[model samples]
Target: MPKFIVSLQSNADYEAAKQDIEKQGGSIVDDSMKILGMITVQMSDQSASSLKSLNSGIISVEPDQEVTIQVA
Candidate 1:
């Protein structure tokens, strides 16, 4: 399974989004960013795509990646 960051519309229903994700076989990983209208989820690529297409409240579903900074 891959992790993705799901961004929701400002007026989107949070509960509805969660239900949509679960219906697509995805699980919410981190919702700490919900205040910012973002959620981290883990699911298959197909599920991710389905969620994106089926859920109108969702703005974008992007891969979750780590960023590192080096001090010189």
Candidate 2:
């Protein structure tokens, strides 16, 4: 399972999408307004990929690629 960042489109149902994600075995990692309407969730990649077409509100769904920051 992988985590993803899901962005919602304008005129989209945020709450509906959130509920749908939970219903489909996804856990909301962060519902914070990353960019106003962006939600981070933990779920299988397959589930996240399919989420786009399943929900009209989804503008984009991308894997939360792990990044290692080097601070010197």
The regions of model 1 sitting more than 4 angstroms off are 69-72
Model 2: per-residue Cα lDDT over 1-72, one tens digit each: 788999998777888889989987899999887459899999998888889887568889988988798999
What TM-score should be assigned to candidate 1?
0.88
Which candidate leads in TM-score? 1
Query: How well does each candidate superpose onto the true structure, as a TM-score?
Result: 0.88, 0.81
lDDT of each residue in 1-72, candidate 1, tens digit only:
899999999999998998899888999999999999998999998888777787559999999999899999
Residue pairs with clashing backbones, model 2: none
Model 2: residue 12 alpha-carbon error in angstroms: 1.0
TM-score of 2: 0.81
RMSD after Cα superposition, model 1: 1.6
> Which clashing pairs does model 1 show?
none
- Candidate 2 lDDT score relative to the true structure: 0.86
Candidate 1, lDDT over the whole model:
0.90
The worst-scoring run of ten residues by lDDT in candidate 2 lies at 47-56
Compute the lDDT of residue 23 as modeled in candidate 1.
84
